[model samples]
Target: MVSKAVVSTISLILVVGVALAVVAFVHHKNGTKSAGENLSPSMKAMIDICGMTDHQEICQKSLSPVAEKGSMDPKEFIKAAIQSTINELSKSMNFTDNLVKNVSSSARLIKMGLDDCKELLQFAVEDLQSSFSMVDDNDLRNMNDTEKDADLKNWLSAVISFQENCRDEFQDAPEYQSLMTKNLQDASLHTDNALAIVCNLGDILKYFGLEFNIKPSGGRRLLSEDGYPSWLSASDIKVLALQDNGRIRPNVVVAKDGSGQFKSIAAALATYPKNHRGRYVIYVKAGIYDEYIIVQRDQKHVFIYGDGARKTIVTGNKNYRNHKTQESASFSVLGNRFMAKSMGFRNTAGPEGHQAVALRVQSDRAIFYNCRMDGYQDTLYVQAYRQFFRNCVISGTVDFIFGDSATVIQNSLIIVRKPMDGQFNTVTAQGRARKNETRGLVIHNCRIVPEQELSPLRFKIQTYLGRPWKEYARTVIMETTLGDFINPAGYHVWNETSFALETCSYLEYANRGPGANTNRRVRWKGVRVINRREALKYTANYFIHAYYWLKGTGVPYLPTFR
Candidate 1:
């Protein structure tokens, strides 16, 4: 028989284990409850600050960076957090008296730990605002791919930790009833407001995709050190005389004043803000501007109307034979509300194996009307998003009209100036990278003509309409007049016996002229010859958002194919 003392001791150990199990079970049950069901001390505190629980989701997203991601900077994230906390705390003026009733001595210790996080919250907000100010537009534009990726990754990690901390206040601390509850609820509301700003910033980024890093060939450079607007300014043009017949001439030799003249047109353009609204006009006299031009983002609602397309020309002679394709471009535009009419843009780099360009328009709301663009290979680079060309004439040889943009060309004359080697003709190189970029070129009512001297049979001398620049190279020819010199096989391969055409989107719709016969047109396996209706879907209204742009601008005469 066991001793009575030994048996009693064994029974006591079992009872202690059972008691511990019961306590653990109760803790787990309370932890799993919803925000409304089993409110933690921190949660209650947050509710007290916010004054209500209605905007819980907003708070959650705002605090998401601080609460979930950790060390993240989002727009309004810090602002929302502080404001929400203040709002919630003000809801109960009697919160201080009730605090004693809810929290025990142990709960007060837990609440103190949360108090430590207050500094972190303040730091996060200050850091975000400071970061925003610190990152100049130029710095942001110049940031390399690696630098951008690393910065974004670091920000995301900080946000994750911050969010996780928030969850701890709501779930782990059940003791300090009033204080903990108030902290949690207030933090949540602040996070929500912050998140609203973050989401808006995200939307803007999605559309612009962070303005591309400045490349040697992409950005504008100054030719003259004299402090003058590289291009004509609105103020300079105001003194000029505009004849009733549309001819314009500068009254006096306009001198650059110290007000805002920059080293280069590109430099001037770079300083433009994103959301600013106003009118800007750059009027040029009948003189050749030998320097490269860059129209920047803040130069919105801008009109660069020249005296004559051929006379008031912006000309450069950089060629691929001497310079790289990107370096050869004569003019570049990166403004939102941009327009260029009756201007001659020429890259006289000749077809001596040079990739010279006449014009490159890389803006959201860009329009080029009655303009002449002349170059050889890789000319007229449509380098970015949402560009349009109306009644413009482009002349080039191989892979000329190429780029990564959602572009539309209507009622334009496309001239193919063949090279001496009798190599390629009419290269409409489309650079559609993503599937979301379904917006491609829609050539409507345009005339496709080869060099006047070239015979119809000369088109067979190794000519192609476009080649695969990306997996989804979307280019279309719709209701255009194709000359007899166009190749019977409307499209040609980027390389012989290649698989590039399988994924590229080459479409033609109801194109007329001697070369439009179906039997003779190149029958690529995946090319799409869409109908008039399908082509119109990519036309003025849909692609340009014409109605929206003109709604309040008071600009009559919207562009149409008809």
Candidate 2:
């Protein structure tokens, strides 16, 4: 795929020429300049505003088209810029709508992807409209500095997030490579320019003898450079224990042959220690336990370990055809501080079974170590809060590792199995509804390989990195081995019509292996080449607050990539 920037450069040149023509006219209107002798008031204003922006060329081009039409007031130019941004967003939204129709009409393969696009694009439009309304509100209630600080800055930051979420929504789509990442990113940059200019409204007004006092809009820092979070403080990881042992003691034993305290794991859970500050360990003997298990929310700091992933398997077959994918999991863990090791969670529902989940975690600080999550689709749903998986084998056909949570999968094998006809394999389906929420999928130092069964079906290379189940979905694959089995485009995005592919944050950093070379990778602007500082934001150390939690869990993981 050709770089959009290169393709659009000719157009930008033409646009810039027209803008210069307008600048000449504005120069004369400002009552100065013999062609290019001296800069006028309007030209100075333009420079002043554009100078504060990151992308000066984009700012000038966007404002030039509007400023050429007789308006010289900085305030008016800011409004025009906002209106132009909203117009671009509407066009992008319409484009996505067309994509929904086109993809839906084509081979049924991309229907799900397009549907997700439509939903996310709709949200993007709403967010842009909301941002525009924020400007309108400023016009109505001449905001004090307090309102400007509290309201305007937050809204502008959200506007940036709006663009990002829109891009991320299609991060894993099929046509991800062909999408208009550059155009959408340009639009975002233009809006950011407007934001930068408008944020200085107080200073602008001060020149008119108005007492408009306000400070700079230092953006909302979602993640620190070090990834250290206030929520995952050191104190949060320590368990209240009566004993001084390094690990938790088993409260009950579960075995299939009635050799332990209970025959079923659920029965063993019945005797769970109450009000215990430390972990309650459940010793499960090696056996195939055919049951659907639910670890309720109250079972705090619970630990479950088996002999091995293959030797001690817990399997079920309930699927979305009979139960909700949100509920059809073989194992649902909702307890905070839950840790599982050397266990296998399987949902034996075949490709046709649809939406079967092996393990769905709705817990905080949940850790899975040396485990195997095997299923066809939606295998491991990290539903809510924070979770970590290390040295695990996660296998499935479609959307195997999914959900909306702050999740990190390190030193694991993420396999793409061949699915039922008409369904392509997508490794991750991130569901992040809100823009500001600290939720995303992190695939770090893992192996992205194809399932051997896929070779027989001739679908060993038709797999995607992920697709957005929500608009604000984010995922990063860092220091991982992406096998040659991956599709060259990397992702199978949601819709082909709009710039949905531009909104996703599907990133990679210093990955090695045949498929890790990014020369032919998706041209999606959101698929970025991040540095170590940016990559470490998704690492176990700072991203999941590993320093506070991993020590006690005994999970062998590097807290930081550095």
Candidate 3:
């Protein structure tokens, strides 16, 4: 027979254990950890790994079965996680597709949103498959393997983004919410956990005595002290006749004082060769030449650099409020392989004036370095083909930087000024209409800050990173510093019924500062944190295809990026 004191003590211990269980249950229900640390090594490993992700508990739970199989190899463990991610993504595709079909709403908006979810889910599946395939490389020490690893990480990130996007699209559609809520959330949670492990690829590789870095090649540095690329040759560096500067003569010079080759920029452009084989460099001297300029399609290989970005100003006021954006640009470019440096293009439209494009670039392989574009809306239109913007200062009110071009805006300052009353400021509105379209927007190593005059309560003002102007819109913001002026939600919807929120691809990688904290970001799959590999793909060297021609221009740009 046990003593009465021992029996009481045993009963008390049981009561404590049951109370702890209830606490754990409540914590788990609230989507957080229970307050305890004692766990098995495998469980701890799961926790440790999942801790790096946004969804730790779910990640650990979903990956628990594979972990129990007892493989400690970090590589094997991660492979299993990725495989799990792939499986979930595939199911998610089917789930979203079936959900779309089952919805009873005949509203076009609901249909459009659901259709967007299916399209993005399909992309997620494809990307996840590619990511899984990439994980089977033979050696981790080789550059090929490193590149493959990078590609895998990018695809995985994309998978997570698409999944989140699918769910966010239905947030406003309460009628279809029940169908998408659980499955989409589960799919996103799985990928978020997978990406948490993938984010540590460098450290994980280090654990296996390996590393991943870009192969270094010997080359002249193209990046200037001002963060711009100096592509000018010795001849392009020279001054015009009667400028009194000791610099050499430019190919064609435009001077308001009539001291150079031509008095007006238009006159000089009119006389330009129609079929030039080599670069035709035109130098514009210091002046605010209020005329609207156009470099036609025949003016290929054109290089236009001005005296200074501020000193040489091109100003106009044509806006959609008055005229069409197609005809209202301060400067229009359609020639391929065109370059511009140290110039200012301005559309002097106020916040109320809409669709005023300062610079419209339709040129393929166009490069703008150390340029200033000032306007209210549609300040810089990256219209078509591929383009690069380096060391530029662009300021506007709404959709200031936009269009369908595959563009890389790097090492630039994008300023958002005070908008018209009751209007929100949107930085980018990418128009990638088709899934197969190669056009996208990559804003890398740039500073997105509010104008100083608009900053007393800047955080109170609504500023979004971007919005999807088209269904297949894609944009990546990498290694950038965003000011506190940015909205916590990061991006906005084009409209309550627009399906763009589902079909768009938006991501941020390695960003910093107060605005970069994603805790308050909208729970949309379109926005995510990407790996180094994905971020590298959008650089000026790689994203804009600058390697081929950038070198030829004597620009010391990274020979491997874009």
Candidate 4:
């Protein structure tokens, strides 16, 4: 017979094992409950805000510290997004700098590409900081303030563009390109998340059950009853009222002959006043200036005009064969609030000399009135920021009018020149890489026609309105007259592999001409034929928020569709 001691021992062991199992189960259940309960209000708010973005995990992780500090304001979240982008970009820039240091001197292109990346990263950081400042300064709770919102979006979009441009510099170096892609991925993602939050800010606010006031559209006016911008100062009105250049007193004068104070435009630019409050005018006499002119970044509120577009010219021939596209421009404007009138900028690098830029504008709130940009390829590079071209003429062959700026060419003429044999023509190649970017090319009430040389060969040499230079390229040809030379397909794909047909935005509204028929246009998913209501969104008043700054420039602009 079994002993009673053995039976008692076995029973005790079974009881102990069951008791331990029960305790472990209770602990796990309580731990899960504790985790749920421990989620702070700030953490929950961060989750809610980040959930609206495409990259939720990245967004949440990047913004965790910001959330932990505990204010649930949507603006704070937006600020955190921008801050995160800035931080990542700084790190990426350092990484690029290290790569530059390690690169072999024999690899010139690679070194140049990395150097360009470093510069671009710096620009991206500046742009993100600008966005951050805007968010921090303004009470974005009033979602109806379109001007502030547009400016914020523009800066963030430019950050993305700068990052993409950095990567694009390494197109020929796949290995380097891959390295850049990996290095910039986090920075790009953070910028994208920031832009997404800004784009869907209204929805995010609504999600928070926050109440805000909307500004009435009817209260805003583009111009006063007396036919002038209501916001123009007395001094500005006086300057605009002067019809004759001789009568208007200029701060400086430039002349090829020794009659003026400065013999060259560059000399006149050197006289820019330090922190002057008002417009500083520079007038140039009728002469051809064979110089590469750059209005430096610090030169703001500069009003430079010439005798006439045909008489006074700034010409150069720096093509891609010798210099970088950014450095090949005959004229580059980097200042804000810059205005150029009755001037001509041309790149004499003929069609054979590819990727030559005539006028590269990186200025914000810039105006070009009655000016001309003449080149063969990559003519007018609207590099960044907001630009307005009124009553101007732009002539080129390939991707002539291109860049990542919020630009409007109104009452201007687009001349399409014949390209080399086997080469085609594309008027615009807008470099908007992200959908949330507010940058685009808007051709309003302009004329697009072929030059006399290209007229006969129009049928043989195909021409497209635009091509997707970047993935989210956007161009709107509305209220413009298209010449017969424009291809029936309307637009062209960048290449076989770069067919951004689904992501790019190409729109034509109320366009009239033989080439304006949408019936035969390419059936791209992103091409659209919209009504007036939709077209209004692309107007000067809405697209670039022109009314806010254009009023000061005194350039006549159609705020809305006629």
Best-first order by TM-score:
4, 2, 3, 1
Residue range 1-562, candidate 3, lDDT tens digits = 4785895686566446534543553546557886554444454455456656666555565556655765555566676777777777677668767866776786655676778677667767766676566665544444232335445554565565455445555555675766676777667667766766776665655654566654567443554453333554333333212122434345789999988889888988887865656567788999999898988867887878898999998888887654545567899997777888889999987777787889999776788888999998889988666778888999997889987777888788999998887788999988775453446898887899999867985867799999887777899987789998899999888865667776788988888778898878777777788888877777765665464446444333543333
**Residues 284-342 of candidate 4: C-alpha lDDT, one tens digit per residue:** 99999999999987787788899999989999999888677877899999888789999
Q: Give all TM-scores, in the order shown.
A: 0.54, 0.59, 0.58, 0.89
Candidate that beats the other on TM-score, 1 or 4, i.e. the better one: 4
Off by over 4 Å in 1: 1-277, 455-462, 497-499, 550-561
lDDT of each: 0.55, 0.70, 0.72, 0.85
Give the best candidate by lDDT: 4
Instruction: Give lDDT tens digits, candidate 2, residues 1-562.
Output: 4676774886689557646644764546657765643445565566556666666776776676544565555556676667777777666667666766666455433444445445444544554565567666564226543433334444444455445544544434536424746446656666677667666766655543455433357532333343433233332233213122345456788889888999898897878767666567787889999988988767877888888999888999998665646557889886787888889999988888888999988676788988999988888988766788999999998888887777889899988788887777788888754444456889988888877778666443378788776666788988999887777777777644433565667888989897787777778767777998888788886666666556544467878872
**lDDT minimum window of 10 residues, candidate 4:** 18-27
Structural RMSD, model 2: 12.4
Cα deviation at 529, candidate 4, in Å, is 1.3
> How many backbone clashes are present in model 4?
0
Best by TM-score: 4
Q: Provide the lowest-lDDT 10-residue window in model 1.
A: 250-259
Candidate 2 C-alpha error for residue 290, in Å: 1.2
What lDDT does candidate 2 reach at residue 50? Answer: 69
